[model samples]
Target: MISDAPFASPDSEPTIRVQDKTLLGFRRSIDNIDAALIHILAERFRITKAVGEYKARTDLPPADPKREEEQITRLRQLAAESDLDPEFGEKFLRFVIDEVIRHHETARQSE
Candidate 1:
């Protein structure tokens, strides 16, 4: 079960009710990591939003397939070096890239 307490502040550890101490510890770690990932993704989108606006203003195409492919290749190699699943990394990146393209398209339509 999850605690009622807010997990907003990193300094304040989130509480969870679990019978196993080890499992509770793991859960808390995962929660913190998940929160951090959300923050990271938010930042990424903020930058991408700016890029979308720039692309729209410059009348540039929303999706660049060559750049996307190059990024996938580079990230897959990095994922392999980090002992993470390259395919998963590529999928995650692709998802983000697709969303960015959608935002860019919207921006273009508004222009």
Candidate 2:
């Protein structure tokens, strides 16, 4: 079953527009953006899933904080180089990493 819009963040709410005769009205907008995010998130998971599968296949443990730290540092540096706010990017990436870890755990449990 479809769940609540996962894209609804504390800092932002998903905007739904009632611009047509659709029964969903604004729900369509919410679904559209939320659906797109799901696709993007799923594509990201494809890569991570491959990583997880390889790890499982090779019997490697999950949750590497050192690797995550290295990644945050590298991405933050890259973000600065790209003219983005390194601090902001770092914090955001860290949050995403945590989310990813949670997703990874859930996926592992399901398997």
Candidate 3:
């Protein structure tokens, strides 16, 4: 019953697509965030890998309490500067730092 020309064609109701479009938007937004988080994790892993290599090459112990303390201090400063939850950020950094040290240990043992 509609004409072929643009002016006479049946116009679609936008709200009819709202639910599907919102779901797709949510999925895409989450995918973008997940990709960014993966990138950050990859960078962290690369740095940890480098540390592992260094420790392996130099026969250095990975657990340096003094160094870790220094790192904690630096991280706390960064959290404060960035207006993040300092305690939580420091704890998370410490956990990841310990994980890096464990990786270094594993690398050492594999050699």
Candidates sorted by TM-score, descending order?
Answer: 1, 3, 2
Q: How close to the true structure is residue 91 of candidate 2, measured as C-alpha lDDT? A: 89
**What are the per-residue Cα lDDT tens digits for candidate 2 across 1-111?**
233453445676554334324747667799899999889878987888777766666656668989998998899889989999999998877877787777667666656
The regions of model 3 sitting more than 4 angstroms off are: 1-31
Task: List ranges where model 2 is wrong by over 4 Å.
Answer: 1-41
Query: lDDT per residue, candidate 1, 1-111, as tens digits?
Result: 366453535765565644557877888999999999999999999999999999999999999999999999999999999999999999999999999999999999998
lDDT of 3 by residue, 1-111 (tens): 322333432585333333465767898999999999889989989988988888888899978899889988998899999999889988898888889888989999986
Which is superior by TM-score, 1 or 3? 1
| Per-candidate clashes, comma-separated | 0, 0, 0
List clashing residue pairs in candidate 2: none
lDDT of 2 at 3: 31
- lDDT score at residue 45, model 3, on the 0-100 scale: 96
Superposed on all Cα atoms, model 3 deviates from the true structure by an RMSD in Å of 9.3
Q: Judge candidate 2 at residue 11 and give its lDDT.
A: 78
lDDT of 3: 0.82
